[model samples]
Target: MSVRPPGECTAPDRRCILVIATVASFLTPFMSSSINIALPVIGAEFATDAVLLGWIQTAYLLASAICLVPFGRLADIHGMKKIFLTGITIFTLSTLLCGLSPTVNALIALRMVQGVGTAMIAVTAVAVLTAVFPAGERGRVLGINVAAVYTGLSMGPFLGGVLTQHLGWRSIFLVTVPLGLIAVALTLRARGEWSTPRDERFDLIGSVVYGTTLLALMYGLTLLPEATGFGLIAVGVVGIFLFLWQESHTESPVLQVRLFFENHVFTFSNIAALINYSATFAVSFLLSLYLQYNRGLDPQAAGLILLAQPVVQALISPAAGRLSDRVEPRIVSSVGMTLSAAGLALLTVLTEETPVPYILISLVVLGTGYALFSSPNTNAIMSSVEKRYYGVASATLATSRQVGMMLSMGIVMMIFSVVIGRVAITPAEHAPLLSSINLAFMLFAALCVVGIFFSLARGRVREDPHRA
Candidate 1:
């Protein structure tokens, strides 16, 4: 468990690794974004309720959140390339099965499996990128990685709409198969492998406790306003305390508990990430429904409209990343958080009669803010850690993201459960749905406003001696 560099690699090896990681990065977000567009269609085809439709997304995120930390530790101990390749193979095959799923239940099950693959890819890609690149180049490289993610998001809505309209929702999953295969094939050809040379045993007991606790917490959130939900949440809170105690005593903890307490930059930066994602991840989910159900737009039209935010995100992320290389990342990210809050505030007034241009303008603002925040924030977190912690660090950051996403959706599902009930999105249900969306926006905007402080409080990453 002593500190050291994970491994070394040549320039060519760096290039190959980046390509594989970027491709893998692009894969998950594309499916996630596209699937949002396909949700209405999927719901109709299955004759399911709104809460059930929300579960389609929740199941995948829950599974990912549960596994991310464990897989990340495995990557650090075993080998990044081995885990990365396996993840791609699992994701691609599971995606195909998801497309062929016979029922809603089957689709949700497969999505959980797909999420396990996502957990493997999510934790390792950044760790691999960090392993190959030096400190000076970290921001630029990570920016490109973030850009690839936004690019997948950019294509998802437009292409997902087209596929759903023409071929059905299944086509959205089927089309990603080729790209996943390409990443796998290229990974096989890459010769470099990286891992921390540690003899520490994997913390199986800690992993189990962590996963089960997170599951209870997330599931409880979705079932809010109910007695069972409150009871489960209380159990989750107690489990968290137990998990922390277990980690502190264990020789090889799955999560490094001290990182949150001892490391100033890592702790606040991760909290900022958690808050930022919690505030922003549901914008598209709410907007897609707003455009289609309330405004009566077709999936294609709604998608084209919803495409604005991620398109701006994809466009600006690299530049923002490069900017972070020069400026203080906290400063850059804090401003972005402010802008995101402003955008969310604007959306709080959305209605059936709200002008299309106003909604588009709000999306543009959110996109700009997100682009500004994401890469710099990522650079800060990655730069704060030593090379040996890269895999766990990456996993920790990804865990924040996945957990935030679950929280964002959990807010929506809870609101839906209370306001709109378990009904389908028929015209009679439109008023309640609109109210739910606006209320969610109000809560999210407040969360973003609170996150700005954490972003600024992370202090300076460049000052950290371990940055190299």
Candidate 2:
């Protein structure tokens, strides 16, 4: 393997690293949504409840979110390639543990460990890519990375379903091992030194406080529907306050508080990402459940049907990213969000009797909108900050996505539970369940409207002055 200087790789060297980053990023989404198709099967095997099942996902998400900032900091301190390789190794080991887990609790614990590895890779992947590519060509390269992510997300359900149905749920975790090994090999081949290392200290206290707060908040939200009395609300309020106070005083805050005030583009872009992801999260999580339980579709069929959104997103993200480089991101993102809102609003009318083609069309529209919005919004966020802060900026963007997805799952579950309680029927009852599903979709559509406003506020930033 040929070694390249930091920030000055040969074409083949850069391409190699880019491929590795793309594959690593792909694993994150694959882990995220692949489990959804297998959730019911896993639940049956483990005799788990909805709340417990939710943790299977929440554990991974919360772990990944909590670790992203700190891991980014670590990457900056150490080397990106070194940290990335270590992360991939750990991720592979964790996947083995997950496959061998004998109980739901054990699986959740292993999933949390897997999430830490995922975060390490995710937080560093973009920074590595940015470092490898020249500024002028970065947009096109990053666009390809975005495309890979959507492709992974799109294929996850189908892959998971096929493995679960044919082999077993354990195969979902087992299959990732080979991919992780490939990522590690590529990472080693792409190794290079760090260009700069700051002497700044890691905010250990801030990380602990932030992690605790997010855990409490997500846990409280997850339990809100089932928890009676004032206990749940009290916990959530306390957690929020604690998080705020800790972040306010920390010298090196994990989440940069000042960024929210300093840059309108960053703030608005993050808000748009939050809302947009929340909408997509609901569709991914709930639709699988709806198809499997209500429509009595097998996991494979459900996964196939769910492919509409991701397939559309994969096709459009690269083009949208490239477009944002020429035109104003604000206009492009706003139009995309508006389209997403419209598509979700259309979902409000879906029923069990609705034809599969209609459902696929609606999802395709939603995916197209998401693809258009995601790349531009991400480009805006990444470009808004100084080059030195790229790692933190990427971590912040990812955290916004995680928070949105977590909130979406919690809120939707609460709505579904309340809707079920109010009616005298099971969720399998198509009419009443359809009404609840419509209500959720409408709520998501309203969120997209908010995202549109935020997207409109992302002011234009010119390309880098130092670019070749």
Candidate 3:
């Protein structure tokens, strides 16, 4: 689909796209973050160890990471509306299956399917919004869409905890079914499908190689500090070289590997995104454990305490998005990264005796920093790439975010293996847990420091004329 000039689109059509994007955006994060609060409950019910329990989250993300790029390409070749609706249907059905799952293994399998659907929705949503909105309004629309993500995150904990506490963890999935249906309804109410006109063949080999590469890399990250894990990491690194070679030689690549080497703005922006998510994604996971297990708070209290970060993100993201339209996104994004580093550095010192107020303040700082960073950074990335690459570009950025999240979880899991062994988290293990959390934060903080440089190094972004 060619980019629609801003004014050429009917106002109703713009609203329809934005509304569908916003609603669809909310479902994934809400489900993910809310599920984070319920992890302890799920783990206990399943009688599974932490490593296995981690798969509940990892499997979905892994599946999404593997499929997003290919699905994005598919959307461009087929139609975004068809892919988006199919994803919504599959995700809703899988969510119901998840709620009914009698076993952890079953749930994990369902989640993997859910992840495939998520990949479809995630990539297509960005492609559609960028396609319909004009350049001048791009940042603002992207910001609003991003804010919906944060809003979902913010609501997930408190609402999820309430449902988990009252109706059991299963209710969380049930509740989302309605929301998913609503999104589907809104999307159906919208008029037409958006997709680039194309006849290019799908690169099946490249897709397989790309998927396998991510699966190996993410799995390796989870097994870190183990000798075998190091071997796996080596294998994954080799896979990367192979994937790149294939992409270069393929007639039509699923991912334009050349962009990473050739497009300075795109490369640095994606790297910056990876760093930012790697540094930040694990915050709530660590904190939920810290609050509930170490600090002796219940799930409800823990959820409330964890709510501060995304709440700030929810509040500030749209404004930051609007700001990026007028100023350089890198300037805004670099400052945000610096602030995130500061917030994370402060968090590294957290102990059992740390005051609640201090923790909340740290969360606020981190949240504020993230809020400023995410939307602007996203705007920079989407704005940097050409219109033809929109689906791939969107998928690439989303993939970086998911991959970084997997890495974040891997870092935490590795620390858990080293610090606490395979035991279930106990009060006796709180000190080691603190050590793990602190270690994760320190690593994350350092990553943010590096991220700020990448944020700056992205060349001055040329405004996308497709939008203009």
Which candidate should be chosen as best, given TM-score against the real structure? Answer: 1
Worst 10 residues of 1 by lDDT: 1-10
User: Per-residue CA lDDT of candidate 1, range 1-468, in tens?
Assistant: 433344466678778878988999999999999899888889889987788888888889889889988988787677777788899999999999999999998999999999999999988887778777888888688878877887899988999988998899999999899988999898888775655545669999989999989888877877888999888889899989999999999988999887877789999999999999999998888898888889988888888988999999878887887899999999999999999999999999998999999999999999999999998998899899887776567778888999999888888888889898877788888899899999999999999999999999888899976575
User: Per-residue CA lDDT of candidate 3, range 1-468, in tens?
Assistant: 464333465769888889888988999999889988888788778866566667788888889888888988888777788899989888989999999999999999999999998988998887788777878888789778877887898899999889988899899999899888888888788766664546889989989988888887777766777877888888889988999999999888898887787678888999999999989998988888788767888778888988999888888877998899899999999989999999999999999899999999999999989988988898888787777766567678888999888888877777777777777655676788889899989999999999999999986775433331
Root-mean-square deviation of Cα positions for candidate 1 versus the true structure, in angstroms:
3.2
Give the best candidate by lDDT.
1
Q: Per-residue error at 336 for model 2, in Å? A: 1.5
Clashing pairs in 2: none
Give the range where candidate 3 is weakest over 10 consecutive residues by summed lDDT. 459-468
Give candidate 2's whole-model lDDT: 0.79
lDDT of 2 by residue, 216-333 (tens): 6676665556654136557667876776677778777766767776778888889999989888786877677678766878888998998888888888887998899898887788
Off by over 4 Å in 3: 1-19, 130-144, 185-192, 462-468
Q: Between the candidate structures 1 and 3, which one is better when assessed by TM-score? A: 1
Per-candidate RMSD, Å:
3.2, 3.8, 3.4
lDDT value for model 3: 0.85
What residue pairs clash in candidate 3, if any at all? 1-195, 1-196, 135-467
